[model samples]
Target: MKVFDKYILKSFLEPFLATFFVVLFVLVMQSLWLAFDEIAGKGIDIFFILKFLVYLALMLTPTALPIGILLSSIMALGNLSENYEMAAIKSAGISLKRVIRPLIFLILFISALNFVFLNNIYPWATLKQKNLYLNMKKKKPALALVPGAFNTDIPGYSIKFEEKYGEEDNLLKNVQIADLSQSKGKIKVITAQKGIISTEEGSKYMTLTLENGNYYEEHINKSMQPKDRAKMPASKATFKTYTINIDISSFNDDDKLDDEKIKEHHGMLSIVQLDSISKVNKIKYDEYTKNQADYFFNILEAKKLYKYPDSLIDTKLDSVILNNFTTYNKSIVLNESIQLLKRTIDHNKNQKISFKDKRKLLNLYDHEIYYRISFSLACLVLFFIGAPLGSIIRKGGFGLPMIMAIIIFVIYFFISKLGGNLSEESAISALFGSWLSTLILLPFGILLTRRATQGMGIFNIDSVLDNIQKLFNKTGNKTTNL
Candidate 1:
């Protein structure tokens, strides 16, 4: 019995790992094949290109593992059954449940691994992949153009060449530029007979060695009645051997603003940071509320005091009271207006402060940070579902399993993405969006696992079809309605 348990466990472990690698390979190979041209044209290094792909595979693993595990498990068990290994065990008086103890443990251990990757490692991979992609674009932007292809990089700047030379090293032949500088209002086409790209220390500049070229430009040029600038005249320029320097610094990836840095800015924020922001928000809200209360109370008190009549008062003593009352009332009015203004201004400031209308903005940041983590963790969910699905599928080969895996993965991917959008739009809570995929698949996983382990029929497709036929049956009982 001990030997049998060890043998089956070893079998599962060996093939599960094998299947996992195979699936991971297929997904990544497909991606690389699709993106190969882009990578090569961009002058991307073999090492970095492979590294980028590795992280991509890591990001994808959680999605692939479960299906591999499922199909492999089914094949492993079915083969054993066909060979009468189960019968041999039954004759030895071992119950089916006891035989599966090792598998159960295996499931628990895999689940734990899934959780760790999802929570930590997976998020790190996501961050790295994004950063790497940004860097890759920066390092080799010339990849965007193919030789003799029209390239549009800079806005209002378009270029075409007869040929490209030597691995983004340089270019040769006819070059054309559309100069809208004079007719900046309208496009002016400028064609040059020749041009050369030159590197200037820290920057890349395209220097045009123009032999003969014509520049067309148009614009409103003149000090005009400020309102009549619309009626201004147009202008154009044609030059030979002219030099124009584009601030391609912005075009370079290095100098461009990074969106990831902004997102992860507060992502690494400590609990202390969160608390501080929350505390500041609380203080502003409280101050606004207090000022509002004071304004209303001042109005109430002013009305009450002013309503006291002159006829009810003694002249000598009441005159002092009356004078003091008038002064105080004016002071109160002034104070109220100032406070109201302060509150209004503060409200406007806070309106844009992002704590009011965007109560979920901070929460959204939190959500975004956790999105990759949840996906990584999805590896575990998929595993549970995949393993059981394979057992029930009972097809002992890769074809059926691969198709089923794709279908399940597609459903999982679509729903989760939809949920993520809903949460970001604040249509649904962030936590809910992140967890919705897990919640949806968990029950199906459990159900499938139990059915597979217990040897239950997977579906009632035949019965369901039969029911459809019966619903439209022409044959009917002739007995009177009872």
Candidate 2:
């Protein structure tokens, strides 16, 4: 290697390593903070917490790499320019492009590494982190319950409460429970005016104490006729105070938690998996759309409605088809037609909601496929932007370069999030949404590189001012002549 190439590589590497770890640490901490509620006071082991952090860091490494490259490139080049080393190299006939050539190759290699992380390591980490979190929640299922939503962390039970408040957050208001433990599709529902929850450490049971409640159990009898099903026997009991002990042995069993159960989430899939699933989903989606269209067509009976007999081909028909019927029959037919139309409209409305949900799911898969590719190239894209920007600004150290990096990265992140949201809603194509930020910044990077190489300022403020003055002068002259 040439001495200059080695020197430049060495300079870039120092800040790159420093910034990469710094960014990774910040991201991991941010994730931990967001999940603090789920982990705090849950009696989870310290080692388990550490393992979660490790998985989180692995999952976020690809995101941190690009930011590190951007900041390091800016600081490295900015330092060289600020210290007059860039000028000395230029005086020695070394072009700006040649100075950055080694860094360019390094960034390309980093980009490929980022791709590997995103395609392989990221999915693995996501799967581990998700399952590990679920296991943690299972360990203390009561603490994981949030008011106003059904909590199914407990097996065979769906629990919800209107409010959870008290010194230890163990008090519940308007508690509702759905028991699904029976083998023969039997259902039991319990509602309480107020309830208290208590669990002991290392215990296999959690007790719920209800103050004022009612229990309703439905008796299932498949042998009964359909007409009698609605009137099937049921049992209801009211109590001033009731206590129930729930067996939580399954929650303590880590061996029962299967990691394979959660591999279908978009974050847990690789590029190949995403592509394959997307293709299958697209086929199913198309088939579903076609089937719906066919079903509605059949319901409308359009073919029958438009059909005419050969004898009636040349005859003038009444404007209303019911005109040939007697008054009583016409009214009856009109009422039936109105009722059918109402049912069709209601069915269409329901189908529309289902279609929208399926479309959004497919959009998520499509976005992930393109996002992996685009995000992997961020290192290269950001290097071009940051390196030239550093040369043009001619500032070194963390003050100005750090601020600039933050501003640029914030803009990029905002655009990416916005595009993803729009794409998910089907307002924009997934390909366009995934690449929007990169496309917006690429030209700016090229412009900065051009100006830096040509020894010009970031923008020609003097020329813009001159044009404004010239426009004013022309306007003044025209007014005077009038």
Candidate 3:
């Protein structure tokens, strides 16, 4: 029995590691392509880029784990069944369940490790990755400039270039700039046949030296007088060389903003921190509901405090009182009632908005908490599904197993994402939304496992089609008799 367990585990480990790294690499490359726009041509440090890649890989671990486990389990068990090892074990009086017992224990351990990653490592990686990306954006503002596009990184200025060259990217050809710093109604345009850009170390300014350029300054409606504006002529100058200096010191500052100032993003908090936040948000939500209820009660009491006879307070307005009251008195009463109702409406509207915001925050915390558990358990759920499905299929190797794993995972991913969106919108309770995918996968895993143990294939298209045809023939015979 010990030797059998070891052999089964060994088979699982080989494909498990291979599938994990392959899936991880593919996911990382996908993420890199998505972020290429932000990182390319940015002149960012190589070390920073490496950090970005590492954190991104870490973030993708949870997403990759379930699929890897599913593929590996399917391949391992299918290989054993294909080679007739499983048949030998069953013939020797060992049940299929008994054969899988050792692997189940191993899967449970991996599930626990996945939870550790989610609770500690995942959150840390999420935080560092976000902050580092923001720092990179700040450190390389010049990367925003692309040839043939109007670059607006500089305040009150827009620059365009037909072409740019050189290792330092200092040479600019056919440069055009529009300056709008001085007056809103005036325009200043500068064009150069060729230009060079330079920045001084530890300086707050960047200089643009242009050769063979023209400058145009035009003022529309000068002096705010129609006649004077028409007479005031536009100024134009042609020059062989010109220079412009702009401030860019903000890009050089290495002082990254403190994470504390951002008030701790929910995605970046650990299990302990999430628990504390959920509790706090719950208290706040309860308080908001209580205060809103009390507010309405007070408004109703205030409306009653107005001096009115019991006779005048009928559910239906009293016709006698309405007829007896003078026009002036009637007008005064109507105005007072209208003012009170308007105030009540305003208060209700404000309270509704406030309560809604608090409840949304509470829902976020709840979703996060449940998400940690559900995603962690997904590993074990997928394992049961994969191992049984492989045995039933009796197909081994990456080709067929990869397709099966991907189809199952895609369904899981789509359902989980939909549930998350619904929970975030408060359309469903956080607990239900977060656990929906796990609940769906659990029964599927159980069904597959049962079929495998019973020596029945889960998918038998030909058998199903033949059964349908037989039913149709019976229906045809009944129709003929009628």
Candidate 4:
């Protein structure tokens, strides 16, 4: 039994590693394609790019793990069944249950490890990836420019050039720079016949040296006046040689946001941190709700000022007494009531918005608490599904198993995403929504396992239909006899 368990474990491990890396690689490539526009052409260091990929891979582990498990389990079980090894073992007095026992223990262990990863490693990777992307966005855009296009990435400036030459690509011809740094209504245009763009070593500045250029400046009047009366300021100058320096310190790769600050987000909080923060937030939420309720109640009470006689007035007033009030007093009361009604409506709107925002914040924290546990347990649930499904289907190899795994996992992922959105919006309890995917798949897994144990095929639709037809025939014969 020990030897058999070792053999089975080895088979599972080989496929698990292969599938894990493949899935992770695919996900990372997809993410990189989407981010290529922003990260590429920026002259970023190769080390930085590699670091980003590593962090991204770490962040995607939770997503990749379940798929990897599902596919690998299917392949392992399918291979055993396809080769008739499972039947051979069962023929020798070994039950299918015993054969699967070792694998089940391994899956449970993986699930627990997934839990720890979710709590610790996942959050750290999420924080790093988020900060890295933000830092890249903050990088100066001048470094991302392409030839022949108007690059407006830089604030208050638009740069364009006709051609770029030389091994270092420092040489430029027909350069045009528009400087609108001063005001919206003013612009300074500089045109150069030929130029060279370069950055000083160990400096935070970039310089453009032009051999021959013409500078034109224009200022539009800010006053509201007739077009003829609006004064326009214009200036022009010609230079044999000129140089312009721009502060490019923002492009420095060393500048990074503090890790602690980035980790303050809810997604970047560990289980322990989330628990502590959720408790504090819950207390604050309760207090705010109670205080707001009381405040609004006070407002409702104060609204009674619009009514005459106040406490002295009976709930059921006589028509004569009510009609006894003067028209002037009635008009004054109506005006005040309208004004108070408007204020109440506005206050209610703001209160509703405030409460919803607070609830969403609390829900997010609550959701993560359950999200960690659900994703951890998803490993076991998916394995139960894949292993039995593989046995029932009686197919092995990457081809069929990969397809089935993707289809099943996609359904699970979509359901989880839907539940997450619902839970985040407080439409459903966090526990129910977070566990929804697992709950839905659990019964299917049991059914598949039962069928496999009973030596039944995965699908018997024809058998079900035949039984239904026989039942109908028997009912018809009974009616005829009656």
lDDT of each: 0.63, 0.89, 0.86, 0.85
Candidate 3: where is the Cα deviation over 4 Å? 38-41, 134-153, 156-204, 208-245, 250-263, 302-318, 327-343, 421-428, 459-482
User: Candidate 2 on 1-482: residue-level lDDT in tens?
Assistant: 99999999998999999999999999999999998887676656577788899999999999999999999999999999999999999999999999999999999999999999999999999998998887776565334778999987777788999999999999999999988776434368999999999999978899999989999987876466668767878899998988888887765654444444677999999999999999999999999999998998899886887575654577766657656689999789899999999999999899999999999999999999999999989899899999999998899898999899999999989999998999999999999999999999889889888888898888889999999999999999999999
Residues forming the 10-long window of minimal summed lDDT in candidate 2: 251-260
Residue pairs clashing, model 3: none
Model 4, range 232-263, lDDT digits (tens) per residue?
66789999888988767766655453233566
lDDT of 1 by residue, 27-79 (tens): 88887777665545554556677777888898767656665666566656555
**Top TM-score model:** 4
What shift in Å separates residue 272 of candidate 1 from its native position after superposition? Answer: 11
Across 1-482, the per-residue lDDT of candidate 3 in tens digits comes to 69988998998999999999999999999988988787676566577778888999999998899999999999998998999988898899988898889889988988899999999889888888888777665455553568999987777688999999989989999999999777554378999999999988877888999999999987674346656666666889999999999887665454452232333778788878998999987887788788877877887885676676565456677688679989999899999999999999987787778777777788888899899899989999999999999998888999999999999999999989888889978999899999989999899999999999988888778899999999999999999999
Q: What is the descending lDDT order?
A: 2, 3, 4, 1
Q: List the residue pairs that clash in candidate 1.
A: 70-386, 70-387, 118-377, 182-218, 183-218
Alpha-carbon runs more than 4 Å astray in model 1: 26-48, 82-84, 87-91, 135-260, 263-393, 410-454, 459-482
Model 3 residue 278 CA deviation (Å) reads 1.3
Give lDDT for model 3: 0.86
* The 10-residue segment with the lowest total lDDT in model 1: 254-263
Clashes of each: 5, 0, 0, 0
